[model samples]
Target: MLLVTGITGHSGRYFLQELIKNKYEGPIRCTVRETSNTFLLDNSGLKIEKVFGDLNDQDFIDRVMDGVEVVIHIYNIHHSPNIVQTAIEKKVKRVILVHTTGIYSQFKYASKGYKLIEERISQFKNDTKCPTSITILRPSMIYGDLCDSNMSKFIKMVDKLRIMPVISRGNSLIQPVNARDLGKAFFTVLMSPEKTVGNAYDLTGEMPIKLIDVFKLISKELNKKTFFISVPLSLGVLMARVLKILTLGKINYIEKVQRMAENRNYSHDNATYDFNYEPMSFEKGIIIEVQEYLKKKEGSKSK
Candidate 1:
């Protein structure tokens, strides 16, 4: 038996889809809130038991952990310590935590929390007090389908603009891994826990692209003749600070402006060496995502 969480999220949905596509013949269980949309998981290969509740409830977690051998945590990284504790108490064999490489961002509280979770999970041990087998995957900025608030959101924002806003030369690099590729990697780890446990890997895209090139790709995909509107990072940050003051903190643009100047580039070669992780190029991935987004838009309009 296997238990998973965050089945509605971008990466979670892909992981589930990949598992089903590969014919995972096991009783799969997942957690979801009452308001979670399961439409993405309508087409499933395994029988899934949807456990309804929040992660903070220990009783609910204990109940969900019944007979579960493996736990794949795709949800909140903050609750990782608790989940790891519960899984340990339940005598679960292994836990695979889906974390993010955004820990590199020093200003992000969420990223700090993720780093804390990693530390806590690393300290876990069984009744024997030996180190527990845990596999943590820190994925780069994930983008795929409409649910992604990263590059997919970038595409939407770019489509809505005649001139794209950029920081400096917009040369700050980014390597965005598709949610679908993360799915395959998760499956590989689950299938070979012995080889994967007690390790952490950075899951990234196949190529590192400049932020400017990303905007170009979006323009090309959307068939828009958008041009760049360059802004110095310092000035953008200052404007954001002023906006924050004027809006009484209702708006804080400094973060977004500063983020544009960051280099999010990374390598997934370790993942490839570890699990044969192979992802399509950014061009192919972005095109596929745009096509899917358009298809969904067309479907919605037909209704």
Candidate 2:
């Protein structure tokens, strides 16, 4: 039996689709919150046993971990150490941890959080040293349809506003992978544990492109050109901090702006060489995502 976490989440949704589309003939189980939306799973007609509970409950998690063959952990990296320890105790075979490429950011707070989790995951992997193999994947900004926090917001902002807020020259390069491709990469790596186990790989898009070009592409796809007003990097940071103070951290102001300032470009040769991971280009990926966004927009209007 293969168990997955966050099956209703962004990458998890894609991962489940790929699994069903490919006709995976294994007993699949997933951990879902009691309130998680299951429309994708429900509409697909795939039989998945769901363990409804929170990740904080170790006993409940242990119950779900029982008799599982491979575990695909798609959400909540903070709980990784606990999950890995539980998996070790439960004697599970293999575990795949889906992390973010934003961990590589020079921004202090975000870097610290991701680094701490990565360190703990490494510690657990070293401690296991046996039947359990933990593979870590750091994927770049994942965007598809309206489910993403990055490009989807950008698409909507561009669609609604005449002027787009851009920081600095928007020359910083960003390599964002498609949620579908990231999902496929997750599946591909999970299938080949021997080669991917105990290894950390960065899964990114086909190529890195300028942030300005990304906006331009979004404009092109939406068929609406917009003016770009460049704001100083320092000013942008100040605004984010101010908003955080105002909202009491409800905004996550730092990550939204600081990440855009740093170059998030990465090499996928490691992921590809390891598990034949091939991600689509941002151009095509964004197009598909935009179409989905349009569908959702139309859906809301109809309702």
Candidate 3:
């Protein structure tokens, strides 16, 4: 049986779609919270065993880990150390973990926890007694869906405002992987364990594009022209700090603006060579995202 986590999440839903499309014959099970909506899973028509409990609970983890040969872990990376430790303890044959590229960030504060989690995974990999094979996938900013946090906000901002404020002239290059591409990459890695196991791959977009160009692409797809207002890095950081304070620490973008000043481009050559991973270009992906955003926008108006 194959065990999956985060099966109801944004990218996880896409991965589930791939499993359904391919008609995966293996017995599958997923861990979901009691409050997690099962709309997709209920309607997916897949006979998946649903186990409800908190992953943080040791008893719950043990219950879900029962009789599982392969595990697809798409939940929060912060929970990985515990999950991997349990997987190792249970002697699961193979485990695929979905991590993020944020661990490579220059900012220590932002990447510290991710780095620590990966360090433990690396140690587990070196342990000779551990029988599980671990493969880690780090994806860049994930977009391509209305539920995504990155590009969807940009599309909405550009659609609503003619004048868009850009940080650092929006010059830094970013390669955002589409959620579908990332999800498919998970499926690809799962099927080819020999090539993917014990290997860490960076899955990114077809090419990196300037941040301003991303905005321009969204504007083009929306059939609108936007005026860019460049905010200096220093001033942007200051404003983020002020906003955080004003929001009583509810809204924080200090690190976000700081990271925006640096380039976030990485090579996916390794993933491509390993699993034939091919991601769509940002332009093409943005066109679809913009259309989805418009449809959702119209949907709200109709309601």
lDDT per model vs. reference:
0.84, 0.86, 0.90
lDDT digits (tens) for residues 163-266 of candidate 1: 77789979899999999998888889899876788788899999899999988987898888998988988998999999999999999777778888888887
Q: On lDDT, who's better, 1 or 3? A: 3
Model 1 score (lDDT) = 0.84
Off by over 4 Å in 3: 245-250
lDDT digits (tens) for residues 1-303 of candidate 3: 899999999889889888888878888899999899888787777778888888889888888898889998999998888888888888899888999999999998789999999999999999998899999989899998888999998888999999988888999999999999987998889888888988999989999999999999999999997999999999999999999999999999889889987899999999999889999989889989999988988899999
Looking at candidate 2, the ten consecutive residues that score lowest on lDDT are 122-131
TM-score winner between candidates 2 and 3: 3
Every candidate's CA RMSD: 2.2, 2.1, 1.4
lDDT value, candidate 3, whole model? 0.90
